[model samples]
Target chain A: MKELSLNILDIAQNSITAEADLVEITLNETETELELSIKDNGYGMSPEFLASVHDPFSTTRTTRKVGLGIPLLKLAAEQTGGHIELTSVQRSVDPENCGTEIKAFFRKDHLDFTPIGDIVSTVTTLIQGFPEVDYVFTHRICEAGSEKLVALDTREMRIILGDDVPLSDPMVLMWVRQTLEEQYAG
Target chain B: MKSLEELAKIRERMQNKVILREGQASTRVAVGMATCGIAAGARPVLNAFVEEVAKQNLSDKVTVSQTGCIGMCRFEPIVEVFEGDNERVTYVKVTPEMAKEIVEKHLKGGKPIAEYTIGAAEK
Candidate 1:
């Protein structure tokens, strides 16, 4: 992917497809490194399926023969002198502790590091697309000895909006965009 | 820091208005958003539709959502518009600019842009 945000969107969709109610995307960035982690309390994968996820041919979709989401992310991370780790516990195996977590570490100073572009839009798009699902997005930046954190939790929004107003409501989405933008600005 | 208090105000304001039930919109816009679609730049197209739908104030009548791969990887960034029960139009290789036009000409004006449809691309 040209942008890390696109990769995030792609990987996050896998969690959505797995019927996850809560997905957490966290970005922990320092001066020289960035760690992107997406964790989901979804169906997760069997050990067999998790083993094949690195292969381009391993896919759950019936539409085509290729699944590039994970592979592409792995490549992107490797290109930046970084690596990725994927761990999952199948729901059938452990119904209580079943989920998947994918963590990618990228070297920010590497020549091939893809920029994290327009993440605010990526997040808003996810909420708009899957309003029923709860998302917790936290971007923590540690640079020049000062740390900043930007975060949003849909569960909190749901508490405020109740069952009547959906998170997908245009007004709510607009507020989300504005709120995130304000956080990034300050 | 931005707070949830603002969201509370929005909810209070929207509580009086009628909320549309899911799948109740007369017009539905579905954007392909699988791995292929995202790799092909569907995010911007999807966002464009969301923005245009809200910008045109058609949120009441029109709903925009995402779909997985339709086995049309080559013609990705595909967008499909559905009207009523059976009428479906698929547009291929859509850009954000074209998404705006789609909302205006098709969703609002009730005319599918023939030139942008999959049928046109096949020719």
Candidate 2:
């Protein structure tokens, strides 16, 4: 992907296909490294599927053969001397915190690594598209060894609306977009 | 920065329509969103479709969704529109601006823009 946010959006779509009702995305950037993590409370993949998840052509969807999201993300990470980690757990009968988590670490200043582009738009689009799903997006700017955290939890906002209003409502979406912009901009 | 006041006004205006548009859409607008698509700038294309559909108040009739690679990585940022029972029309190398036009002409006007279709792109 040209931008890291685009990869995030694509991976977030995978979480949606997995029927995740709740998804969490985190971005942590420092002088040396940029870390991205997307966690979903969806139906997890099998051990066999997770083993070869890096293969671009091994896709479950019959519409097309190649699944470039994860494989590309892996390549992007490795280009910067970083790596990707994917972990999943199928939901149990009693229900543990079962889901999948994909994490990638890249060199923050690598010339070949894609820039972090339009993350506010990325997170908000997911929120707007999936009205019923809950998303928690956390962005931490670690500069000069200090950290600044910007966390957005849709569940909290939903509760504030008395659980009737969808987050996709125009005004609510506006609020969400503004909130993320302010976090990154400030 | 977009003002919340403006959005609040839209919220008031769209309150009824939002509720009315909750269901399966007759026209499914699927955007290619795999790695190649993203590399070719599909995120904004997808967002443009969503924004345009909302702008035209065609959310009930036109549904926008993302899909994986269609085995044509060369034609990244592809968009497919499936209307009723007719075969889908795949548009290749779509941009954010083209997304708006497609919505205006095809989704709302009931005619596909031939120049932007896969037939033109392939040939």
Best by TM-score: 1
lDDT of 2 at A86: 97
> B-chain TM-score, every candidate?
0.94, 0.83
Fraction of true interface contacts that also occur in model 2: 0.28
DockQ class, candidate 1: medium
Residues A1-186, model 2: lDDT tens digits: 678888898888889888899999998888888999999999888888899889987777777776778998898899988999999987752256779999999997778788988888888778866778899999888898777888788887765654345677655876888766776666
| Residue A174 lDDT in candidate 2 | 68
Candidate 1 Cα outliers beyond 4 Å, as residue runs: B19-24
The digit string of per-residue lDDT tens for model 1 on B1-123 reads 667898888888888775545556788899999988998999999989998898998988899999999998899999999889767999999999999999988899988999999999999
lDDT of 1 at B55: 92
User: At residue B34, what lDDT does model 2 achieve?
Assistant: 65
- Scored against the true structure, residue A109 in model 2 reaches a CA lDDT of 79
Residues A113-167 of candidate 1: C-alpha lDDT, one tens digit per residue: 9999999988998999999999999999999999989999999889999998989
DockQ of each: 0.80, 0.32
Positional deviation of residue A6's Cα in model 1 after best superposition, in angstroms: 0.4
